[model samples]
Target: MESQTVEYKSDIPTKHKLFKAEIVAFLNTNNGTIFLGVDDDGTFLPEKVDQYKQWESWISDWIHSAFSVPVQKFVTLEVSAQNFAIHIKQGDKPPYYYKDGEGFNSKGIYIRNGSSKRRATDDEVRRMLKAQVANEFESELSNIQESLTFHYLQDKLLDNNIVFDPKGLRLQNVDNQYNNGALLLSDQSPRVTKIAVVDGLDMSADLLAKKTFSGSLIKQVDMTLEYISLLNDTKVSFTGAAARVENESYPSKAIREAVINAYAHRDYSLSADIKIEFFDDRLEIFSAGGLPDGLSVADIKEGISAQRNPNIIHVLDKINYIENFATGIRRILASYKGFHKEPMFIVTPNQFKVVLYNRNYALVDDDIQSWGNNKLKTNLSDAEQLELGFTVNQDHNLFDDSCVTELEKRLDSKDEKIIKLLRLNEEMSRKEIESYLEEAQTTVYNRLKRLIELKIINKRGQSRSTVYYMKANESK
Candidate 1:
């Protein structure tokens, strides 16, 4: 039957162009077998026996001159007394095009489409080029001459009863010649892994803390995880009978999987670093390189993965850093099912970001109606106006008189404090509120929830970057 990898020719065609297309198609695609004596209807008609050697010679010379690299080794001619078959193996370096002045540019690259050969489109050619680069990049040798150390990786492998000797390293593509993958796992590789904690939601805010970890990538994974774990605080709730319900700010498994995914799949060719930013409302992990070719965000969410660095994945898998391929995104989503806000993935041509919101700092939905309440012309109670330190002027009106009266009736002292703080600033984060009031974070959180319920203020942004603003107008 006709397929992408098989083409049948009834007899030797008169023109060399027909053979050229089929051979180029096979080299661009997977290895294919071309049967010379077979017709579309499966009838066998042999070509002149003496012409077999001539045809083979012509094809070999044409392919060698047309491609940038020698393709003679990939082309083989099988000539039996009764039949002839031309077999072409897929080329390692692809986008094989016709020689210049053959009436085509790089877009002249061809691939098998069903049983026919067609020129590749610009996007298709680009994908083929990227795939070629990705496959060769990790196994390529690096110039780093420093003696490599793998104490961390060795210990991890030894714990699992796996030997990590030089021979084993070469087997895993980490040879003494120091491949790019080896540079990544080296103790003094130039790659940097950093985490930044910001006070505000975006980088516009002050930097509270920043930590950089360098060394072997495997060791960086552990060090980064340990640093993040310190910030993944647990909240304890005591209801009754000495029972406590504890919840972490971010799920441990989800963060671990994301970190592992960053290290294993990130593009090492770029000089960019892998960064993790912690804001008051959310955590974001940024890795160099976008989704690997032939993959989309939806595909990843559905558990489809394309490894950009197979050798890194191989070494990581040996050390138990990655349990299964293509399951990281699924596991991350599953870790937040039902209760936590779902994670978000942002992909660009050069970068991929994972955003995880803090479950405990989620905004109360009641605050949605209170946005834009600043235009309301209602007067506030004397005590409420005094607490907010505002006079009911046309522009400074905090809420409608009715909404303000309702708010004053319901707000406790801490609620009043949060509302007062939001009144002074255009917006305030949960942490900022906590700091201003010198109160416990949970206490500030509860007070903000109450203010939201009273419709005195509205929540804006999300995650650690979330901010509270006084409602511009109150809903009827």
Candidate 2:
């Protein structure tokens, strides 16, 4: 209990965060032994020996059920001298983490710093990665949630005659241990793709909509694309040569490639999530981490891609999520052809951003929206049309006159009078009905509300402007 590789606990911390955190810390740092049935002062509880099986089963279940990544092979338990010990070996895959009811603590990487344990700094984690020969973070084994389903992933790969083989897909290591990549592709993936729709350009602008997509990575991509597609309004220009020239505000191909690239090339090591923001004038996609060292915005524009998560890219490729390794930028650029504004790729020390300009931002037309009355056709009476020297096509009437004839047989005599007035005229205001029936406004209003519900006739306009009309179909 006093050694550098040993930690003492009088009992297993089943409900506390310390239980898994201590083991994960050991795996991320130097391998260590956790002594149960013993206190830090070296006091041993002999009764715990009888409950070793229960303790072991509980902990084993936690590691298996609670974690997404398979890391059971690295931890073991032994019992002797009234002390049950949990032996955690230093993992070949660094940065092991623990998850609780609240979910994964990405910053849970811990190390033994002499007498106690502490979180490993970014430098230490980077050093660990270097020592591990720069293994991609997605390739590292995890125990965040051991049980993962890939039904969505399987469907995507199914057409290619590719089965969901974790090992073959590099989602699992050679030992069949699922890595972070598996967690991402799994149906129970914890990774999230967040999007914000703002009324204006920046964070200071009003948020119009917000959505967070999760589950399988491929599913997230598909769903996010579908959502953006809905927002990317399609405009048709009738002015063009007999054929319709329809174009989306932003080219859909560019949006798909840009979104997939955000997930495929983003630095998975960073805790920050990929951010996609939709503004009135443009779309901005920002992923954690910049282009790999020695790569610049110019290189990216020239179609040079330095994949930070190649393993992730490979899985996506199997499902055709990517068109080609480095063609996303080129595709985005090509989409803006003939447009005055060009797409931009911004690279900072910690973030990589893609800004896509909107093509229809300036082409908004108010003439397309009509402020006409909500009627099937014109509000003019047949007499008015005839008086204006216009032929009122009797066949073009919205109301089926036969429909009013049928209602006459079912309505009360008082309601029949109102119905008769509407039948004589194309439409009638509430005041006109009240005047004809010589009834209180309240009585006429109640009759109209019921008639509208019965679907005998339809009501239009609002308040004093409200008018009732008999129609062949129910009002929307």
Candidate 3:
């Protein structure tokens, strides 16, 4: 639980100054509940009636006079047996203090982080103050055509045939004081500034292949899907001693999701444009924004959904362009159900990117086959293969011997995807793998459970929506 959910005690020095400091601490931390009038040992014994009234008055008087911050919003209460529960919520305003000429003197400015109310270090206080000011000056945009429709999303994205309402989209109940609203809804969106994309493996290539999407949000949606379609439909030929081979890794859903997330979660406040770049071997989507507050690519397994643009998310979820509060990173990992190569993510100071590589090719079908051949090898059935080709051909990349050497360093030989994914890309999602790798859903779950047991990965979240990511063997 966040710091804001505490059972209070009279043992907490209800003297005026200390009481005010504690209340301020709770607000700074996670908004928490405080129980008043309860003795240290959980007894319901009330204080003397006269003293109780005086204590209440003292509490009220100090709160009004002591804190420069607004007390009304942060403090909420309920009472039973003279025991009270006071709720203090986390505030957007920071560097808030309990005052009276002794500015941060004995009761220095404190911040609640996790469960501890530590004195705010200079850096923490500065960041909080900057965050407050940055939040206050967010840009606002007008002239959005209400009738502008995203019907075009349905036209270009073929793998998932979803429909949309002709009516435009809106983000309701957004706390404008803390959110960057206009940048997300603008027609140019990520296109306002020039976009650049790069291969994760090769960061220095100025002339690398890149594409741009133009027009309204609907038009941009179409443009992005059009680029994704090129990847989905592209085929590369590989020649083997056995025969000639053609490979098409057409899991369009994965590309769509990566693109959608780039648009939906990217920090539009930044000047950089969104980018879709295809490397010789991988496809990458770069969004200006890094992961939202308190989230990282590792959070893929955590199954946490923190959208930078809830209004945009609202419309995307409503029209089914994206799943409602669904985690996209998890879905991308699922796309590699029968394959060995996993997805990757790279996070930089102001950007977050998702990368998917072409599936590795194997010379013979059996060569790429997993340990279990019959029950779970490939998505294509015998009849499907027959229809696909009477003369099947195959080819494969040279085995990555270095990965094996890296693997041997492990005390135990466990080949879990979540582990493999982290080794390649620190952020991999178990839920995403489950969603895309539908055939191996149970197998993935079991593998994750075993990894967690072995303490190779840490599991978080609840139910079928849980997330799994790498954990140090010693960390657990």
Candidate 4:
């Protein structure tokens, strides 16, 4: 009747060492209950349950004193008329040792091999060390303890006026050894970010560029962004009375946020590197591990952030690199809020990925209408149309005096200036525009009113909080 998670004993063991191993096995593996008055056949013997309270106290005290760590918290003794159950929950810290006399032995460590407890192997002991620091992985001692440097990260901290204190940053643990956090931020870190820019839409396309960035993770992220910026091309549109709209192929903020998210939350235990594939149609950032245990795609989309590597994110937050708003997933979605092409988040048991589509994917010769004869324009939003770089009106040239000259005449120098200012900033308050324009309040108001009527600019909010921006109804 006994299984991996359930054990029955007719009565308490005569020796302390025998029963202690059973409790340790439960802690190391999945938690199990040891029933005092239950036999192997699941037969209850109330006569065998004599002195239950004394036996319970004796077992609890022996476990607290015999283990290498304070494991009393993981143990619970439940007493009822039915039986005495020693309930041991799976421990957060592993390698729970049973001391022989005053000193602990490697053989003292036990795990549930099957239904029975056995001495753990050397490899299992090492794994237990990792589990001990699971919540703060950066505090785990580095594999390479010698010759680690943090020049790049040091300078970053210096620029931000923070002293380079390894102990203060938790780059070193209690033993004063350089921890995994220090290794990652050091100049000699083996971890690297790999990026492949495909010339075409998929991997079958020729390789336009391929790069590997190494050194400190902070440096790697910056270097990767710099290399990708060459591929993040911008398209300029010169039509419409509105100032020429200039947009990047992909949102810069979204790209950076995704990279940071991959870096901070990735499973460092895996040897696999962070891989980014840059294609004409989309960018996919593949991190080593999948979503944290119990996290779902919908939960992540709603800005629920679970830390797989808490210390790595903590360091980034201290450097002011983090957005200090919602999770990176939310910020990435915000970047593509008004676009038809949005980002996709994919997860497997061993992988987590972010796929961002190019906002300009539907453009042909910098014109959306020319792409399949405006087939893509049927359901596109104002922001999507703006990114494609064209005016809705028949007059293609915004600056052409003869083409839509009536509309141009209506937009005098002041209206043109307002439009130009709005183009620079996606949205500006009436006060912010007036501060920059330094013109009469009545004159600017009249120009803003006229532009809104023409729909050259859109007004949002009300009274003092009201803001005006080019390409009307973008928030839609």
Candidate 5:
């Protein structure tokens, strides 16, 4: 028997190019398949023998040499008559582009955008290119003594808190002119490579409060975390219904490791900034690069050291920013385990995002209440729900603010009926929700009140009116 999975497409030409781009995009970004010649959209164009044979040859030719690198593509027949499907799978090397019968096509590159084909933007193209480049630590940082300002770094470290011997941190070769620069660990050295804070709705220039570090990367990291701490306001609840609020879940050590790894592993040649997203519940740090070659998520867990930037690594070592030679990831995991939660380290082509989930001790003591007649679907606490809400809000590509808030509140209140309704249409307002459930305004308002108090749902608008919505975390 033949494989059931194949690339399926309708008779729509515009959609065909989009699907080809989608298949190409999936091959470029991660890996997936695209099927063509299927009549799912009711445009069942019968396959002709001569035309089918010609198209097959053309597709084969396109797949082999039409991309920056060859992506996998396969064509096969369906079980039905005159119907067929094509499968375009992803390959190991990413950032694949099509020749476009002339020059390179960037926007034409398609990726799976939730069951649809969407073109990649210019930013995505640059990210892909960075991912494709092979980075070796020793080879790049060999001539750092000559290439960068090592003396200035030493002075900065002495002036700051980093008490280390400069001789141990100096680059060996003084002759080579192309060595990667180093990061100093001094009180004056700014450990954060970059800091970006966005206010209001969109992540636009007007809403963004961005800052760059001029000192050594180590100091910049320290300064960035200090600023992040200022934004973190913690609130704790007790079994007696008493609430204590302060700056908690601010795991300084875990954050320091995350920043160190980000600075040490970032692709310096790239222009994107290191990202620090501060919200009400949690913080997200995104380094502008990914894991080094031959290193996977599993390898990171193995506590192996494959330094991507040797110059920066050497300087950090001297200052004790890195405690163990090969135990950064392990330490981070262990720290999170202590809190009864897991720290997330995500690997993207152009970014490494870390999430330090909040553990509200007070909320943990209380038993989880179900929504809609006691359907306990998730094992998340009240504080976890708030963290999930923050995660959903910040992740714009996944959901909007309203969706996440609603999901959390419904889960907390044991309102299962509303939870399913929100799952189908996340943007539903209080009125729409009332209409859908055929309930009274007072009931909906009371449910929404419970949600807001729990931090599961956030209220937008003002006066004698409002919109009640769920957060992305609620869906989970």
Candidate 6:
């Protein structure tokens, strides 16, 4: 109803060229309605009722010859003599221009801007041309060597009971000439996916481990998931009776979906690599390029998706890595239902990031040391140490030397408390240790199990009668 995509004119122009620019603008834009006898303020005043038939004949002939494709079907004239409205729908084949003698040159292209028509800029014209060719960069033929192999992708497809044939590649927009999507799925794709484990919440701390997974996109997704699974430590909890509860550092399903979504939807035009970082209390996955055009975060939250790389998505879906399009975010959120911290998403024009919290490690203050070697000292700043709930002494030795052994060094402060209490009492039941430490029964149980796994302490008996003690031959 507003004048944004609608325009008004006092009367049909005698010189038809005066209104031809407006027609080209509407065809190039979202299409619009033009009222010949309406004022700019939207007041309808019929002035040229007698010339309606002549005006319609002239407009129909002009549009048919002006555009690259015939657009007479897009125009409609109101039959009512009291109101003259010519409706123009957006052209399916864009970059609509005036038929000048030069033959579709820069001078012909017009675009709608606000309430006026203007000549499209060179860049705008180029973009329109690209859009006309099916908005997919991955479908374009690649200049890379055609002697390419997709051994990894083939194996995955074979396992899924699907034949990996050359014709299949063409069907999926991949041909003998390797395209961008084919390059990504090739056995020797140069794109590398990386994961880095840091000693602290920030990268300023020491790098514990850094691994790069490359080659085919399928292999990279598989290898990355395997590597992260190895790092997903499990925590234990004990209650009234001896209970062993397994707590995963990060939800397995969420990590898989995030990694696959990153590879599937990433903008390959950008050379930036996908990065997965592990911190003290969270994990961050950064993928180059943001949401696709016309898509927003809210749209993704509602399970709406616009595929920026349809070719890549097609291959990924066929491999069964993606069950459905637009369901990755919803699946990621569902995986964190019982988790204390929800996943966070940060989207920008050129980048998208997913931040997942480590709920198991959330309450473990001294878990930061797990990332360091036995000889490594705390590199955390004074403020960071305080924030982590650690009281720094002048000596800077947060843990007593007597409480740390080669195997027990990885244990957190609470685990040390349980060990100290056990050593002092020689042997203590689960209830006795929980009572002495005045800690949550679940916390005590997790610590006790961790100590046992480290062989720093031994648990004897079962159920409510279970008691823990340090190994007799082991020295503190």
Q: Which is the leading candidate under lDDT?
A: 4
How does residue 372 of candidate 4 score in lDDT? 56
Estimate TM-scores for all models: 0.57, 0.51, 0.53, 0.54, 0.42, 0.60
User: What TM-score, to 2 decimals, does candidate 6 have?
Assistant: 0.60
Off by over 4 Å in 5: 1-134, 137-152, 155-172, 176-178, 183-192, 197-210, 234-247, 338-341, 360-476
Residue-by-residue lDDT tens digits, candidate 6, 1-476: 44648888876677655588788888887668888766778786766677778777877788677666678877777747577788988675678876766466677678877888889998777656654453366777766755678899889989889888645654234334657678778887878998887756898965656788899888988988987875676564433333345667788989998989998887777779999998878999999876764356887989987677777777778878897658899999999998778899899756899999897776565555544532433556546555555443221112333443444346665565665555434578888777656789888888888777766678778898887877742453
**Tens digits of per-residue lDDT for model 1 on 1-476?**
87877888866578655567688788887678898766785566664556677766776687678655567888888878766788898776677766556454674578888888988888878767766676677778777656667777778889989887644554233334667787778776789898887756799975656788998898889989987876675554433333456767789999999899998888777779999999878899999877774457998998877778877788888777887658999999999998646999999756889998887565323233443343342344434543564333211234454555466456665575565455435477888777656778887788788777776688878898888888862231
Of 1 and 3, the candidate ranking higher by lDDT: 1
Give the Cα lDDT of each candidate. Answer: 0.73, 0.72, 0.54, 0.75, 0.55, 0.73
Regions of candidate 1 where Cα sits further than 4 Å from its true position: 1-105, 110-131, 171-176, 238-243, 363-476
What does candidate 4's lDDT look like per residue over 1-476, in tens digits? 78888888877678777888888888887678888887787788888767787787787787678787767788888988777888888776677878787765787788886678888889778756654444456667888887988899989998889998877887887777998878988999888998876656888865544578899999998887776665675666545455666767789999999988888878777788999998778899999866653357897888766676667777788898885454788888999988987799998756889999887676645453364534354456545666776344332212332424345448665566666556534578887778756788987898899877776778879998898877533764
Backbone clash count, each prediction separately: 15, 7, 17, 0, 45, 0
Candidate 3: worst 10 consecutive residues by lDDT?
393-402
- The regions of model 4 sitting more than 4 angstroms off are 1-137, 323-326, 365-476
Best by TM-score: 6
Worst 10 residues of 5 by lDDT: 390-399
Worst 10 residues of 2 by lDDT: 390-399
lDDT of 6 at 333: 95
Q: Write the per-residue lDDT of candidate 2 for residues 253-318, one digit (tens) a residue.
A: 999989998888777677778788988789999987766533567878887655567788888888
- For model 5 the local lDDT of residue 151 reads 49
Q: What ordering of candidates by TM-score runs from best to worst? A: 6, 1, 4, 3, 2, 5
